[model samples]
Target: MALLSDGHFHSGETIAQQVGLSRTAVAGHISQLSDWGLDVFKVKGKGYRLERGFSLLNAESIKKHLGNTKRAMIDVESVLPSTNTEMKKRIANARHELADGDAIFAEIQTAGRGRHGRTWLAPIGGSLTFSMYWSFPDGYQSMAGLSLMVGLAVCEALKDFGVDDAELKWPNDIYLQGKKLAGILIEVEGQIGATAHSVIGIGLNVCVPDSQYDVGQPHSDLTSYLGHTPDRNSLAAAIIKSLWTLLPKFTQQGFGPFAPHWEALDLYADKRIVLQMGEKRFSGIDRGVDASGALLVETQDGITRFHGGEVSLRGNR
Candidate 1:
C-alpha cells in the first residue's frame, strides 16, 4: 500500500519483489485494500495504481511535525474497527501500562462510530481518524466543557492551516459553511474526585470523494473549503499539539477561559435552533455555551441550559 500510495502504477512482479511476496500474494493484498474503500486500478501492463494519492499516517512524520514535544507517544495502524474502541481497550485492559497523551491513528475504520449511535464511515485515506488517551487527575468531575475545548482546538488547528472560517457547533462538532466537516466523540472512565482516563476520538473529512460523502447530512470537506488541507500526518500533528496544550491548561483553569472562545466560534449562536431529547423537542435561540460548556438557549419560557447527549439537532434545525 505504501509503495502504491503515489498513485503511480507498480507492477505485480515489482511489488512482489519489493515486499518479498509472491505475485499471487500481492494480488490478494491489493484486493483487500480495494475492499477497504481505496480505489485501485489494475491494468495489464501498468499493474496497480491508486485513483488518488495520499500519505498514510506515519508516526515519525507526525512526531517531527510535533516539534520536540515529548508529551505524546503515537502509533499508526493500517486499519481498525474504531480508534476510540482501541484506546478504551488500552485503558481497560492495561491501565497501568499506558501514559497520558497515548494516541492511535487508523487509516480506515470499518465500524467507526459517532454520537447518537451513528456509524462514522469514511473511505481509506479520505479522512483524519484517530483517538488520544488523556488523563485528568481531577477526575471525571474536571472534564466539564472538555469536548467544547477539543472542538476549539481543532478549529484553531485548521485556522493555522489557513482555514479561518471553521466554526464550532456546540457540544462536539466543527462546522464549515454551516455543514459538518468534523465530529468528536469523547469517552471517559473514573470515579468522582479521582483521576480520570479518557479517549478523545476525532474524525475530520479531509478530501472525501463526493461519492462517499453522502451520509444524509449537509457535509463538506476541508479540501473543498480550503482548496486543500494539510497531509494526514501534518494535520494530525497540528490537532494533537493543540489538544495537548489545552489538556493541562484546562485542568488548572477549568472551562471558564475557553467559554469566550467557544462563544466567538459558535456556529448556531443567535440562530433559531431546535433540540430533541427522544420524542420531546424544544425550540429556542442558541445563546452559545456557558462556562461549564452546557449550551445556553433562550426558550419561550426563559433562558435554559442543556448539556451534551440531549441536543442532537441536525434533523431538527
Candidate 2:
C-alpha cells in the first residue's frame, strides 16, 4: 500500500522484491485492491499504479504528535467497514475495561457510515476516518447537543490546518467554502446507574479527486481548497486533541457552553432551507438552534423545533 501511494507504476517484479514476495503472489494481491476501495491501473507494459496519490495513516505518528494524550490509546487500521461499530462492540463487552478518549482511525472505510442510516463512502486515503470512545458518568440525556459539539471539534481541527472558514450544517456536518467538507456521527449507549458511553465517529474529506464519488451532496476536500494535502497524521492528532479538550466541558455544562459558538458557525442561519423528516418536508428560514440543541426553523405556520432531520438549502434539488 505504501509503495503504490505515489500514483506511479512499479513493475510487478520490483514490487515483489521490495516486499519479499513472489511476483505471482503480488499479482494476486493487486487483483483484490479494488475490494478495499482503491483503484489500481494496469497497463500492457506499465506494471501498476493508483489513479491518484494517497498516504496511509500511522497510529504511532498520530499519537506521538498529540499533546496530553497519555490517558487514551490510539489504533490505526488499513481498512474497516465502520470504526464506530468496532468501538461499540468493545464498549458492550467491557465498558469497565475501556478508558475515556480511546480511539480507532481507519485508513480506508469500505462502508463508512452517516446519520439517519445513510452511507458516507470515500475513496481510499481520500478522507480522514476515525472513531473515539468516550465514557461519561452522566446518562445519555445529559448530552443533548453532542453531535454539534463534535462538528465544532472538526471545524477547529480544519482551522488548525489553515482552512479557517469551516461551518457547521445543522445537526452534524462541517462545511467549507459553502460545500460539505466533513461529518460527524455520535452513537450513545446509556447503562444502569446513569453511566453512558458514546462512540464519536468523524469522516473528513482530504484529497478526493474523482467526480464519480457521490455523497448525495456537493462536497469538497482539503487539498482542493488548501492547494496542498495537509499531513493526515498531523490532522488526525489535531482532531483528537480538540475532542479531548471539549468533551469534559460539554460533560460539565451540558450544551450551554457550546451553543453560542455553534450558532456563530451555523451554515444556514437566517437562510431559506428545507427540513426533510422521512417523507414529510418543511420549508422554513433557519432560526438557528435553541439551548437544547433542537433546530428552530420559521416555517410558514410558525417557528417549529426539530430534534432530528436532514437539513439543506431550499430548492437545492
**Each prediction's TM-score against the native?**
0.94, 0.91
lDDT of candidate 2 over 1-317, digit per residue (tens): 88999899999989999999999999888876877768889887889999887777888788888956566888898868899988888887865477888899887677788977789886678788899988778777777889998898888877888988899888988888888888889888777677888899998989875476777888989989999988999999999899998988988888877888999999888888886776787887888888779888897799999886455344334
True lDDT of residue 130, candidate 1: 94
- lDDT tens readout by residue for model 1, 87-137: 888888854477777889998798899997789977787799999888888
- Rate residue 235 of model 2 by lDDT: 94
**Highest TM-score: which candidate?**
1
Candidate with best lDDT: 1
In candidate 1, residue 27 scores what lDDT?
95
Segments in model 2 whose C-alpha atoms lie over 4 Å from true places: 18-21, 44-46, 210-212, 309-317
Query: Total backbone clashes of model 2?
Result: 0
